[model samples]
Target: MKFILASASERRIELLSRVIKDFKVIPSDFDEQTIKFNGSVPEYVMKLSKAKAEAVSSATYAFSESDVTVIGCDTIVSIDNLILGKPKDKQDAFRMIKMLSGKVHSVYTGITIINVNFDIIKCDYACTKVKFSNLSNQDIEKYLCLEEYEDKAGAYGIQGYAGVFVEAIEGCFYNVVGLPLNKLNKMFGEMGINL
Candidate 1:
């Protein structure tokens, strides 16, 4: 199968590389804010993932080979229903980090797989709880200097320097990183793509 990943996330790329060795990266251009869901966070994530997969799948329909599977993923960090997307700037990043300090938040990663030619589709999500340490202004400033918060949902990368700020985590650790490796692998297996 010709596998296509519908994201440019470095973390997602790295996590997927563990199971699938060769694949094409075609970032999805779907605007997420356009989507409004009245359901739970999991439902919202699934909708976004499906939209991303469908967007890329439809756009490249005529160009795909006989066996092609496109994967789309989206991650969100939330505290009591307040969703935290990627930070806008330095101040935004700082604000997000400070809010997450000393509290546990939920990280949700939605994954969608679709075979345009065969009409096969799947959508699911994984949630992990992450607790951040009580950070001082100096601590936040020091971590912000690393500048790894721009593309992360929670203004922090668990695999980067922010790892030290994580007090505890429940559920899949990879979910906090971006993509849930276990969930992704399981989806691939269910689709009959052994790897």
Candidate 2:
């Protein structure tokens, strides 16, 4: 069987490399804007992950003769039930970072695995509570200059300079980085796929 990752995230790719040595990266073409948030962050991420996995799986299924497993993932930060996705611009990024300063928020990552040949599909999510230290406007401005917030949810990347912003985390640390390795390994084990 072959393994494929339906995402182009460098963090996720690096994380997954710790478990699986060989896999292909096939970024999904699914447009996340098409999905609306319906008050459930976990479900929302799961839906997006599933759509991404299905998009890649369907696009490649016909071409491969062997079985292929496609893994898709999505991450988001939520505070007060409000979802914070990638910032549209610098000001938006600053606004998101400011809101998270000195506050506790939840980081959610949804994972989906699909084996088209076996007709198997699995979806799950992981959430981590993160507390940020108080940040002055100067600190926020300085961090924004690094441009690390551009493509990251909540206008921050826990694995980047934003790591200093996190005072505490209540759940899986890897989840905050994007992919929950423990949950992912367990999911693969449950599906009888040895990584």
Candidate 3:
């Protein structure tokens, strides 16, 4: 079966490739910010993920690709009641880092798997509790200078230099990276698609 990933994230592509050798990366053009869940973090992500999957499915249908599965995912970091998306700019990056510094946050990733010929198969989301070590102003500044926060949720990359800031991770490490391997595999099993 052909597999298509509906995301622009190189990180998600790399991780998914580990399980399936042959898959296409067709980034969905859906505007995520337009989605309005207006509630909890998991609900918001799930709604966004569904929208993305629908977008890609429509696109794929236009192209008429049968016997294919499309997967769309979205990730977010939340602390307290605030949802932290990618930093708007450098100063914004600094501010997000400051909020996360010396505190624990939740990372939520929602994956939606769909096949044009069948019903949608999904593993809603995986939330990993991550604790950051107290960071000095210099640490935050230097991290911002590295520019790793440009396209990462919460203004930091758990797999990059920001790894230094992570004091603990309470769930799937891959979930924190943007995709949850265990949950994805289980979803595939439910769909009768095995790697």
Candidate that would win on lDDT: 2
Tens-place lDDT digits, model 2, residues 1-195: 888999999999999999999899999999999999999999999999999999999988667657899999999999999999999999999999999999999999999999889989999999999999999999999999999999999999998999999999999999999999999999999999888
lDDT of each: 0.90, 0.95, 0.89
In model 2, the runs with Cα more than 4 Å from the true position are none
Clashing pairs in 2: none
Tens digits of lDDT, candidate 1, 90-184: 89999999999999999999999998789899999999999999999999999899898878897888999999999999999998888888988
Candidate 2 at 113: error in angstroms? Answer: 0.4
- TM-score for candidate 2, residues paired by index: 0.98
RMSD of 1: 1.2
Task: Tally clashes: model 1.
Answer: 0
lDDT for model 2 comes to 0.95
Measured against the true structure, the TM-scores of the candidates, in listed sequence, are: 0.96, 0.98, 0.97
Q: Which pairs in model 1 have colliding backbones?
A: none
lDDT of 3 by residue, 1-195 (tens): 678899979999999989999988889889886987586899999888878888887788777777879898999999997999999999999999999999999999998998866766574888999999999999999988899999999998799999999999999999999999998998888887887
Q: Which structure is stronger by lDDT: 1 or 3? A: 1
The order of the candidates by TM-score, greatest first, is 2, 3, 1
